[model samples]
Target: MSALAKQTITEQEFQGFAVTDFPASKRLKVVTLDEATIRAFNDAVSEWTVQGIEYKPFLRFEVADRLDAITNYTLGKFLNATVRDRATGAFLLNYQGSPNVEEGDARTEFEVKLSTAVSHIIGLSNHDAMYGQYYARFTVRNVDDSDSYLRKAHRRMELHNDGTYVNERTDYVLMQKLKEENMQGGDSLMLHLDDWAELDKFYKHPLAKKDIVWGAPKSKNVESKVEHPVFFEEDADGKPLMLYIDQFAEPSNKAEGKYLYEMGESLEADANFLSVPMPVGSMMVMHNHFWLHGRDKFVPHPDLCRELLRQRGHFTE
Candidate 1:
C-alpha cells in the first residue's frame, strides 16, 4: 500500500460514531453520523423546515447545536479541529443511511437543512451570490451553455480556490452531491498546498506576493473586480496559503500572465492531488486557502444529470 493509503483508517477505527480517516488522505477525515445520532438530530430539529431555518438565521445555529448535542458535542469539536488545523484541513461528512424524510424533493430539502446544520456548526456560510441564497444548488448535464466552467461535462475542471473575486474571507467550502443520473467520471479533485511539489517554487517566486486582479463572469453575479496575491497569506505556522485559479485572474503584464499560466499547468500536472468519489448524500468540506478543489470530466450521455449543493463560508474564529 502507498504511504497515504497506509494512513487511512483500519476497520477497527470505525467503532466510534465520530471521526476516522478511513479514506486515503490523512488530511481528509471521513466523519460518520451513526443512525442513532442522525435520528436524535433529526428529531431534535424536526420542528424546523428548511425554509424556517433559512428565514431565521439564529435557528440554524440552534439546529447545529442540537446535532452536536446528540453526538455529545464530539462532532462539532472534531469538525472544527479538522478544518482549523493546517496539517489536516478537510473532511467528508455523511450518515450511514438515508435521512428520515420523504423521497424526492422532501428528502432533498432535508439534505439541505442537514447541510445547513453542519455548516453552521463549523461557521457561517457566505451568501452565495450566484444563487442569491446562503447556499447554492445547481445542476450539470450532458449539455450546458453556461459562461463559467461550472455545470459543464466532458471536460476536466482545473483545480482552483473559491471566493477569489469577492472581498469575503472564505475560510471554508462545503460541497454536497444531491442527485445524479447517467453519471460517469466527475469525481471531486482536491490537493493540499503543502502536498504540491511546486508549492515552494511558486511561493518563492518574485511574483508570488504581487497583487493580481480577479473578476468573475456575469454568471457569478459578482459586479466588481478584486485584487490579491495568489499567495495571499501564511497560516499561523507560517506555511503558504494559496488563492489561485486559471479562469478568473486577469493578469496585466506578460510576466504576470505567464506566471499564472505556468502555475495552472503545474497544478494540473501535480501527481499528489486526491480524486475523491463523493457519493450522493455525502458532503466534502475543506479549508479554502490550503486545499484547492475541482471536478473530473463526465462521460457524456444524453440523459446525464447531476445536482450539487455548495456552501462557502468563513471560519468562526
Candidate 2:
C-alpha cells in the first residue's frame, strides 16, 4: 500500500463526478462521472462525429472543454493533477451509470470521443504507427496470428513500460475497453516504479544507463530500431523512470542481455502491482514512465472477443 491517503473529493467542489481510491491500490484514483455529466457531455459534442474530431485536431480539445465545462472546469484540473503526481499517476475513468446513448457502434463512437477528450485534456497522443492514427483500436480473439503478444488471448503480457521501441516520448497511456464478449480474466496489470522493491538495485546498476537497442515486431509497422537504456531518465524528485519491454529489448552483449532479462523477471515478480478490471466504456490512463502496464491472459472460449482502444503520448508542458 502507498503511504499516500485516498484523495477525498466532494460534489461541492464539482458537478456530475466523484473521485475515490481504487479498492486494490491507493496509487490509482477511480473517477466516476454521473449520468447527468455524461448526458451533458454527449449533448455538448453531439454535433461533432468521431471522424470529424479525428480529422480536425482542435475539435478534440473542444470536446474535452465541453466535458470539463460540465464540472465548472474541475474535471480537467483534477485529471491532470492525478496523472502528473508520481505518488498518484494513474486513474480508472468510468461512469456511475449508463451513458445516454443508443447501443452498438453509436456507443462505441461516444467511448472513442470520450477517450480522445480525456487524452487531449492532459496531452496529445503520439501517432500510433500500429493503427496509422493517433489512437489504435484492435481486437483479441481465441485464435490469432499476430507478430506480438498484444492480440494473443491465452498468455499473460508481462508488465513493462511502453514506447520502449519508439523514439518518441510516450509520457502517458490511455486504454479504453470499447467492447467485449465471452471474456474472462484479462484484467490490466499496473506497477508503480516506487513500489517495486528491486527498483533501486537495477536503477543503480552500471548497465542501467548504457544505450541498448530496441525494436518492434512486424505487426508494430515500424522498420527502424531505437537505442535507450532501461532507466532512460529521472523524474522531478530523481526517482528512476523506465522505458522497457521484455520482448522488444535487443540487448547487444551478454551483460546487456542478462540485465534486460533480469529486469523483466524482477518486474514480473513484484507483489505491489494492481490488477484492474476495466468495464466496457471505461478507460485507464497512467504516467508511462512511472507506471508499467500490461494485460492478464483471458480464459479460452470458442467465441471470445475483446476490443480495445489505446492512446500513448507525451505530456505537453
Candidate 3:
C-alpha cells in the first residue's frame, strides 16, 4: 500500500469516464470509458486512418483533441494528472462494455488509433526503430526465433525500466493488448519504486550513481551503446527514477556485475509487484522511470498468439 490515500473520483471530475483504484493497488488508476464516450470517440476519429495518422503526425494530436473535446477535456486532464502524479502515475483505460468494432485487422487498426490518441494526449511517442513507426506492434507466439526474450513465451521477462540503452528520455510507456488467441498466462507485471522492498538497500549503495554501459541487441536495431546508472536520476519530488534492463546492462567489472545481478534478483523476488491481466482492447499507460514492467511467461499451446502494441515517449513540457 502506498502512503497516499486511495483516491475517489467523482462524476464532477469527469463527465465521459469514471476513475477508480485498481483492485490490487492504489498506485494505479483504472479509467473506464462509458459506451457513449467510446462511440463518440470512434465516430470522432472515424475519418482518420492509421496510415494517415502515421503519415501526418499532426493529425494524431487532432484526433486526441477530438476525444478530449467529447469529454469536455476532462479525460485528458485526468490522464495527464495521473501520469504526472508520483503516487499514482499509471492508468489502465478500457471501455465499460464491449466495443462493437469488427473482429480482424480492422479491429487492430482501431486499437492502434486509440493508443495513438492516448500517447499524444499525454505526450508524443518516439519513433520506434524496431517497427519503423511511431508505435511498434508485434506478436508473441509459442515458438519465436527473435533474439530477445520479448517474444519468447516460455520465460518471464524480468522487471525493469525502459529507455535504458536509448538516448531518448522515456517518460512513459503505453501498452495496448491488440489481440490474443489460444493464450494463457502472460499477465503484465508492474512494480513501483516506492513499493520495492529493497529500494533503499540499492539506492544508498556507492554504485547507485555510477555509470553502467548499456546496449541493445541486433534485433532492437540500436547500434550505439549508452551509459547510465540503474537509479539514473531523481524525480521532482526527490524520489529515485531508474533506467535498467537485465538483458541490456553491460557491467564492466566484478563489483558492477554483481550489483546488476543482485538488483535483478531483488526485483524479481519482490512481492509488491502487480500481476495485471489486461483484457483485449484495453490499454495501460505508465510512468516509465518510477514504474518497472515486464510480462509473465505464457502457458504453452501450439497456436498461442498474443499481439501487443507499445509506445514509449518523453513528457512534453
TM-score of 1: 0.94
Model 2 agreement with the true structure over 11-106: per-residue lDDT tens digits? 337567889999988889999999989988888999999889889988988898888899988888788878988889999999976677899989
| TM-score of predicted structure 3 | 0.95
RMSD of each: 4.3, 2.8, 2.7
Off by over 4 Å in 1: 1-16
Score each candidate by Cα lDDT: 0.87, 0.90, 0.89
lDDT of 1 by residue, 1-317 (tens): 23343344232243327676845788889888887777677778888888888788899889888887776676776777778777788999888865677789878887887899889999999999999889999999999999989988989999999999999899999999999999999999999999999988889999999999999999999999999999999887788888988899999999999999999999999999999998898899999998999999999899999999999998784
Clashes of 2: 0
- Please tell me which model should have the higher TM-score, number 1 or number 3: 3
Q: What TM-score does each of the candidates earn?
A: 0.94, 0.95, 0.95
Better of 1 and 2 by lDDT: 2
Regions of model 2 farther than 4 Å from truth: 1-12
lDDT of 3 at 181: 95
lDDT of 1: 0.87
